[model samples]
Target: MFNYPPIVCHHDFSKSDLSVDTLPKNVSFVRPHLQTAWGEFSLVEATVQAIKLLYESENPPDWFILLSGTDYPIKTAKQILTDLSLSQYDAHIHHQEIIYKVYQENVKMSVMWQMLAYRRYCSWNLFSLPFFKDFTIRWGHPLLSKPSPPFSQKLRCFAGSQWFSANHRTAKYIIKFHSQKNSLTSHYRRRMFADESYFQTILANAPHLNLKNDDYRYVDWSTKGAHPKTLVMEDLPSLLASPCHFARKFDIDVDSNILDQLDTMTLP
Candidate 1:
């Protein structure tokens, strides 16, 4: 559907289906070394490897978009390329600092504590008390204080959704940064949800990247819970109105008709 050549970086982790021999010519299947796990950096590592593989391919991509198996495009491949080509942003990623000021605006103080409920640095002792609990200290005073991040103050941290879209240059920068075992990377590897903060922290610190604080992916957070609400046939109207390149959290088993509608609908 695209005028330009599009290369897809697909990494399958399921044990049931490791073979990709029947995939389209454009899809490049990547092999991940580690199993999927929560609060682990393996997912982030696999993603970086996939990006590296894409860059090394014969027909390297002009843009790199991070997505999961559940994600689906809301716009045609041609439309996506045209929109990205006309834009000047180096990276499209949403970010917000994990501090009181940012969270206090719309979230209660209690909610803030729950968000950072896990102290990833303490993951070394899996058998110890407070194994995966947040850490707080008296700090020689009656009131408790939150522990500082493992990294030095020089490297600021930002948190957001893991998904992103970026030009090839930005993708190169991310891989380069990941290779170094600096305090930032070491600290992030131990983070509870490293996927959410790893790339955001890197891009936010690099001022020369021309970052835009939007990933152009529609995700509904209005519903209560950790995961976003799954898209259904009823959401087609809003999905199109979002003006986003993709909308995620779709399940083919639950509602495949939405995909049919999206495939046939004409963009205005």
Candidate 2:
């Protein structure tokens, strides 16, 4: 089994809010100071910094797996490390192509028209208007226009699912790419849901980061919905049956029992 160390990027909000006391010994928790007007950027910076520090230490792990606090391991850390070490691939999993038309119809109307219609309304109730504030926060710039170009031609595009694991070389490439591509990053910041799109487009388009197979994180998108479907207690049987190492969107508050079941079935 691969024996690389795990780095967990936890939010400062969790320290006082969540009840996580002792993580696994191999896991390193990095907490970034929260910054206003740059919710996701703070996270990105913190992760980049953590990676750079690890690289500089001369004792960096063989691979780095990026995960969120909401994510839980469906398989043992040993199994995940072992699988990655044995594999001969140098790729990240990303959607081949996103269905933009869906966004054009649902998201555009909700984002663009609502903005145009209620610009003054937003200004009137700055604190009270949740929808207006959300709209302005996400897509407050000119670049995120409707009828976005097809996935191939768009010099500046977006992709979904920011979760990924990469070798040290690829991690370095991402850091350099972000530094160099300021224009693209700025454009992305103003767009809605930049977190998902930013990383996906960058990794998918990069020539060196040949993301081949979807790094098998089991997400239940079975129910008809926009977001990836959430996992519940009933999904345990199928989740364990699958070979994926992790499953996500489990509610820590409500569905913790499922974790107990998984720990019994998958981990030693």
Candidate 3:
């Protein structure tokens, strides 16, 4: 959205809707927009599917970013491009090692994040009883003969926000990893909220790539909930000052003026 650049967009929309779209000539949507919902593997599947298509396209992009319909850029396109032009990393993603065990209270993250990080990314879709929490059910079965976790000491698990930015090489790796029914993809396909960990684990495990631990997205998580705080007009100053290229979860119904203001700041 900075200057005229090729844009590939995808959504869980209908065929007619795709035909009626009003967008720049450089923009095109990948075929077969699959249906997905919150906290489902389909979310990761849809995104990775689009990435695969883009990677294999005749005119593959040098870089690609994963974003939602609600996400809006705060920085100008020139600024974003300039930052990336000088970057040394192959990917920019928000990431942290997931221990997949009972969390210690002294962890730097908040209580909610600790719980999420400590919780297992389960491939098994069964009810779990939260015992003393000293031990988690490993998101799979814990017993030796039972279903063990897909990851191990070598394939340590990592997680972060679902959104990320990657260059062509990294995108190729993601496509390669997802193409086969390996342990990672196999277990993550049935895991709860796979989108949040699927790409992250893949990116982290790649020793050949350099990655920055920042996703370049601003999301206010100060409010108490699974969802981040809904951005409003009052958050404009903070948004402008943040180093992130984009901020998310804004609602026009709540405050359309924020989008109007951001449009002015980000528009070329």
Candidate 4:
């Protein structure tokens, strides 16, 4: 089993808020609140910072797993290690091209447009909008159209869920790729849901990385909602049987008992 160290990156955009005391020995809290606005660049920046921190640490991690606050482990530590040890892929990331033409025809007009051209420009989420009069922020200049050479030709644009697990080598490659490809990073920064495509595009384009195209995180997109449905008691059996190591969008407030059930199954 691995030691869990909570490296909290508190983003300060709207307000300054942070509180911590009596920390665990392994827990290393980043005290300063990074000046980050909501969107792709901010998310990318946070990830880069985490990677940098990891590299600088005395004990660098072998595997870099990105999980949101809402994410919960579906498999025990032993089980997760067993899967990783036996896996041959360099990285685990579920990805595909952004072309959603087939999906667009099946859905309603409103949903169709959103799914079809949602990544055309930035500001898909309200947090990036001009909600606050004085809150000035920027990700990148919006292009009149997709780049002339096509992003795919330049680096191969891929889209998928942001959560992923990559070995240290793959993680370093992503950061290195970002450093070298300034123009591509700048262009993606302005795109809606940049995090979803940025890393996927980078890793996918670099075929030598040997990405698995399976993020190993269970998410139910079948419910048809703005986000994945919150896992409830009814989802317990399926989740327990899943090969995925983690499951996302669980709300304990909705059903705290589900967490208890998961804890019994996941913990040693």
Candidate 5:
């Protein structure tokens, strides 16, 4: 039997069944309104919708954990639930003052270049038109930064892992905070790398939850890229030995062996 609640959010409602089929009996579906802004805005809308569903539910979940399509469990459902119950601390984690120098540098350069390019081209063709000038001036700044007072003080921010598990009260705060700061949140959501930085910063700044070690699944990051290294059959032994409850970036294609091994290990 499954020990915790599960909720799935899909970009496309029609494809929801694929995920629903894989979940155990306790899981349910919470579909977000289709918002196709990409990156941070998309994630913000998805998060807000998920929390709203919980608030409206007759019996809300004790906690909510976010996962991606690429994630897989390394521990049994029972083991995970048991571990969570024993902890007094809320599950949200943030690495304090984590340096994100590289990301900041890249964002500054990219923003500057985009502004220059848009001014050069759009100024002549688009801005020269009478009504278009006011429209362009009003909307053009949004392309630079939306809803505003930028999300973070740093030029760029590093988001270690996107996954998190938060108790119901904490989840409520996240939703409420965003609602009050809708303008600022909306602006930063359109900015660079806000997807990773926004939530991390908000949670870190929250008074209720303590920022500590990350509680979600773990994956080796020695290789380097935008994501953690995908687990392979060869990595099975080490993965099993690690205490992390989940690990991810699994290839849905050829990484089936790792999943097979996990099934045998966690289920048996």
Candidate 6:
């Protein structure tokens, strides 16, 4: 293992099975955890909280990596650490400019379209009839102001995977920016799947952060669904061959064989 300290941020909504007392001295939890759910700003806030804490720690790491429980390392710890050491970019963040787009009825759309639709629009609870809800209809204020701070014609929106790696400098920048309540943060609070866009928007906009448009995480999305394909034993070959340091959406319950094999491969 890397042996780097971890600041576990528990979601307020879900109880953590981790025994706090048994955890190492370097491992701690973020105080006053908030309710977190998929596609919610709470997920963003949780990440921000952990970053802030880690950045302010007594012995802050030179690099920071954000990951979920479902994620697993494909490369060895030494390989990952060595990669970060020789990396030129401040952050490995998968990102792209998000365009404002509307859905076409009965038309198959890409995930980008789905991301734009849910991220740009807000749902209302105005309808209460049977099989009707306020959120059933998506409403948006696409005609943003000429000078919408943090986001406008000049400062466009960018989005990407929520998980990634960043150097200490970029990590510091994130905490400093997010610590203040800003228009960007406010707008993100209103949108859905804020986790995917919030950090990306900030990183993309920062002038000094040397960013690479690669998150170093492999996720198979070939199958049809809003979520990525759950990794299994069949994916072992691709996972090992990929340049990515990590691969995600693994389900040990579905097939622990994959993880078992990886464990053998990763043993020093």
TM per model?
0.82, 0.69, 0.85, 0.80, 0.70, 0.84
lDDT of 3 at 116: 63
Candidate 4 residues lying further than 4 Å off, grouped into runs, are: 5-16, 100-154
The Cα RMSD in angstroms, rounded to one decimal, for candidate 5 relative to the true structure is 7.3
List model 5 lDDT by residue over 191-260, tens digit each.
5444555676667656667555676577776775545688899888887788777888799586788898
lDDT of each: 0.72, 0.59, 0.78, 0.70, 0.60, 0.78
Give the poorly placed runs of model 5, Cα more than 4 Å off: 1-6, 14-27, 94-158
**Candidate 6: lDDT of 204?**
87
TM-score of model 3 vs. true structure: 0.85
Among residues 3 or more apart in sequence or in different chains, the pairs in candidate 2 whose N, CA or C atoms overlap within 3 Å are: 2-82, 91-211, 92-211, 159-197
Counting clashing residue pairs in each candidate, in order, gives 0, 4, 0, 0, 4, 2
Worst 10 residues of 5 by lDDT: 117-126
Error of 3 at 1 (Å): 3.4
- Candidate 6 per-residue lDDT, tens place, 229-251, comes to 99999999999999999999999
- Could you arrange the candidates by TM-score from highest to lowest? 3, 6, 1, 4, 5, 2
> For model 3, which pairs clash?
none
What tens digits encode model 1's per-residue C-alpha lDDT throughout 1-268?
A: 5543545554445645566677678776565445667657877887888888888788777787888888888987778888788879998998776542333456853445334533332122234346656543312111233434553355666777889999988988988988887777876665566887888878888878988889999998668666889999999999988878989989999999998898787443
Which ten contiguous residues of candidate 6 have the minimum total lDDT? 118-127
Q: What lDDT score goes with residue 59 in model 6?
A: 84
Candidate 3: where is the Cα deviation over 4 Å? 14-21, 100-111, 122-147
Candidate 6 lands at a TM-score of 0.84
